[model samples]
Target: MIARWFRLAAVAVASLALLARPAAAQQILRDAETEAFMADMSAPLVQAAGMEPRNVQVLVINDPDINAFVAGGQYVWVHSGLIAAADNMNQVQGVVAHELGHIEGGHVIRYGEGMKEATGITLLSLVLGAAAIAAGGAEAGMGILGMGQQAAMGKFLAFSRAQESSADLAGARYLSKAGVSGKGSLEFFKKLQNQEYRLAIPQDDSYGRTHPLSGERIQVLREVYTVDPAWDKPVDPKLEARFERIKAKLVGFVSEPAQTLLKYPESDRSIPAHYARAYAWHKSAYPDKALAEVDALLAAAPHDPYFLELKGQVLLESGKPADAIPPLREAVQLTNQPLIATLLGHALIATENDANFAEAEKVLRNAIARDRENPFAWYQLGVVYEHRGDLPRAALATAERYSMMGQDQMALRSADAAMQGLKPGTVDYLRAQDIAMVSRAAVEQKRKKK
Candidate 1:
């Protein structure tokens, strides 16, 4: 369903929203758990680097091509293929540091903007916003994109030779600052430089097209990692493991299922790769095989809450909803997971009678608490409230959803029903204010952009 259309409207909505603040990275990608794990692992630890993960977000694009690029600000859209092909934490960190270099050196804002303007794509912001959204909810779906829609690619790129050299030099310095040996950066760039000819594009249009790098980049990088060099730091063990896990998982989910299945071995040889393959099998709906794989993972690391959640999902897919409850419950209790709440809510509805409705409500409540803007969660909560004879609550939830979607009349009508016999100072009134505020902010941002 996602691998279709360039949802210009959705992207427009998102790009407009970003004027106010960066949406949660999960918004652009469907897999919330993997992103959360990566976010945690990428958290700032080394104070000497003068960098904070909060300000610089690493996004995984669902593209199979070996590419990664930066937009204005601290966003680095890494192609899923790059993540899969780049083994271990160091390679991933090296790639990310290079991107961080782009951010630190302001290549995205300084060069990307200059090019976008030069190419007559200023209005292209809205169009590209639409394209990004159509690439599969770039606002909220894990930088949802595939190689399929390079259809419109006439090279919306920028960055001169000097800019690339600067980014490379800066990236090397950042590797040292962040306390990750510049080793990863050198190795990764060396491969790209070496394979510049192997790529389908002409030499002139390599990573250099988007981010120019001359001989100086490689020249400096080689010497930077030399023994007793100016400064080189070791990569953290914990951060390295996480990079491998996220990169591998992203690979399976984005790659062709069959192709991914063949390459993704469920083995102790590399636990992260095996886990990613297991996830891909589940996504492709081979639940029995997925369960077998996840069970092996559990045996290897039984305390992993994520593995437990995966088990629950597989059971649900394999027609054993009853068996799914325990593990999912464990996952939620451990992390208060957002997606698990929705899944667990549905599982409860399927297995238990009306008496189990409360469990579903709890899930709905948590989902809403985590993301007030998620329409699906609000609608589910409304349904639960209506089922429980809580007419006002149902009306309020539905009305708020309508208001947020910009259906003002419907929102008003629903609010009228919801606020019946309701006091002015009640919860419904408070919710109404919150809804109106969000709608106002959204509208105001659009107007300002225009």
Candidate 2:
């Protein structure tokens, strides 16, 4: 199962969306398998861009919009819709290449340059308009103000277009350097071109838009890509196979059960089809059907950690936590993935056996140690602490989870509780104090905003 977390971040200009807005809260979808796949896919391109693989992150946003963006760091956020829309892994790699260009070029950091230029134009126009009004030329003042606004907009749009063009070129160069074909990059641009046609977007008027027309992008990229040595190279078969499974899994997870079933009919019987149908069945509350699909998958690849994880999730969510333990335990041992370990810990705690509490505590603590960003693991750890009658530590865990979810008021209260209960000058007491201070500051900031 994919976990969802809320985080506040800025959405950058390197998006396919026509309209732009300020920083906002976004829902991030986290799954061990999807994240691992994205990391693997983007690693080559990240290295080609002269960055450490560990430093660059590819995050999946739980949005249905067909877009990807860099939010002011070495982070590339891809909408789930983009994955559903892609035909193959190479197409997504192409997107990764382009976003890496934005990261490497520091476009997000330089975004202020364009805004400053546009603001200057608008301010100048305002001064001129004021002078005209003072001279009693009211009509001329209004006309000057309107023209100035339009000119300022045009200036910003032009600057944005230049950045987009530069990123495209840089992306092509990175793809070439990585020995990856640009065919997928060109093909994805064509997909955008077709989408523009479908949406009845104006193709000729590039001046008013933030991005260059997809047709223009294709035309420009095609020239560079066609000459690249890797243009005709074939995608890796193993990687393509993984992409297909992930794409199907995402469709099943995000789409309506009926739509998933329709898209991956029972008659198909392939691994990806099985993956899709299993989720569809599970979501529809037919555990038997879902288990049957899982069994079929296990028969095909018994050692696959993800399939085992899915089986465990289905069993656990279906109210059979005891039954879910074996597969989930195996999944944890096989992968040592924090997400899988979190699930296993949940299964242990859900069993309600006091003997299982120690194991659950250990498992949950280990999972949180490796992935401190996982709010769910922290919440589960809180549950374990409460079950063991450790109120102070439980409150601290609650604070940790709430802080990650941006619920600062709740975090502040929990941290306050933990601080009062714990011994002064101890590590946990100090951490509780730190949380309290940070949460109080965040709460005050929210009050000011309101």
Candidate 3:
């Protein structure tokens, strides 16, 4: 299941400039298996780009657009729709390679140069137009204004196209250095080309566009890709198999239940099919049916941790937390995935058994130690503290959760409450104070922006 975490951050707009929009809050989909897969896929490309693999992150956005981009940091933001549209893991790797190219090229950082040039042209035009209007030549003034605006747009678009082309070449070089085939890169471009045709997008008019036309990109990249030594190399079969499963999983999770059933009918009993059907059934409120699909999956791959996690999730969400514990516990042990551990901690707390509180606290603390970005884990830990009658630590936990979710005011209040109860200079108290300071800064920043 996709663990949805809402983060208040600006939407990235570096690559796929054609789809650029105003900054807004976006949902990030975090899943242990999917994240691990993306990390594995991007590792080689990140190394080839001369960057630390640990510093580069491939994050999945919950949007349904078939786009991916780099947003001024070592992060590649991939839309869920991109995964669904991809035919293989190599296709996704190709996209990651391109985003890394943008990162290495410092295109986002250099974007200000292009903006500055365009702004200068616009300002010059405004001055010239004002002079013409003062000289009683209104028509000429309007013409000057129109020509200047066109020139400014053209200059900006040209700059954007060049950056895109440079990134494409850089991506090809990285793919070659990493010993990965460029076949998927070319194939994905062909897919985009076909989409252009379907949308009746003009292929010849490239000057006014933010990105080069798909046909033009393919024509230029083909010369480089066809001559690469790894052009014919086969993709990793295991990675490709994982890609198929996640692709189907995303489809089931995002699509309507009826649509998922139609796409993966009962007759299709493969692992990917079962995975998709399980989510569909679960979303449709058919716990028995969902469990049946999960059971089928488990019967085939008895030791698969993800299937076990699915079983645990289905049972837990269906109001049977006790029954969910066994599989979840095993899943947590098999893969110390913080998300799974968080789920297990939630299940333990949900049982309302006082005896379970100690284990829940321990499990949640361990999970948070591994990954502090998870807000739900913090919330579950807070519940454990509350149940144990540790009010100060519970408030501290609430502050942590609210801080992560960008609720600065609520975090401030919770942090203040926690500090009043906690002894000064202790770890928990200091952490609460840190949250209070950070929340104050964030609140002030927002106020200034407004």
Q: Indicate which candidate wins on lDDT.
A: 2
The reply for model 1, stretches above 4 Å from the true place, is 1-27, 30-33, 45-56, 70-75, 102-165, 200-208, 214-216, 227-239, 265-270, 367-376, 389-450
Q: What are the per-residue Cα lDDT tens digits for candidate 2 across 141-244?
A: 98888777778777877887888888888888889999999998888888888888998999887777778888888888889999889998999899899999
Q: What is the lDDT of candidate 3?
A: 0.86
Ranking by TM-score: 2, 3, 1
- The TM-scores of all predictions, comma-separated, are 0.68, 0.94, 0.93
**Model 2 segments beyond 4 Å from truth?**
1-24
**Between prediction 2 and prediction 3, which has the larger TM-score?**
2
After TM-score superposition, what is the CA distance of residue 151 in candidate 3 from its true location, in Å?
A: 1.7
Residue pairs with backbone atoms closer than 3 Å in model 2 (clashes)? none
How well does candidate 2 match the true structure in TM-score terms? 0.94
* Ten contiguous residues with the weakest lDDT in model 1: 1-10
Q: Write candidate 3's Cα lDDT for 1-450 as tens digits.
A: 011111212122111112343122577888888888899888999999999999898988778877887766788888898898888888888888988988999987887788778768877887898799899999999788777777876787788788888989989999999999998888888888888898898887787776788788889989999999999999988988888988888888888899989999999989999999999999999999999999999999887988999999999999999999999999999999999999999999999989998999999999999999999999999999888789999999999999989899999999999999999999999999999999999999999999
Per-model CA lDDT versus the true structure: 0.62, 0.87, 0.86
lDDT (tens digit, per residue) of candidate 1 on 1-450: 001111121232222111211223323554556667556644542122356666666666556555666766656666676767675667666666666666667664564454444334334444655576777767633222222122112233223445566666666666665556666666666666656545454544434243443233556777766652433556667767766666666666666677766776544457676777787888888887778778877898886777888788889777887888888888888878677777777667667478778988988798778867556677778888888888888888898778856676667667767767456787777776565556556657767899
Compare the candidates by TM-score and give the number of the best one: 2
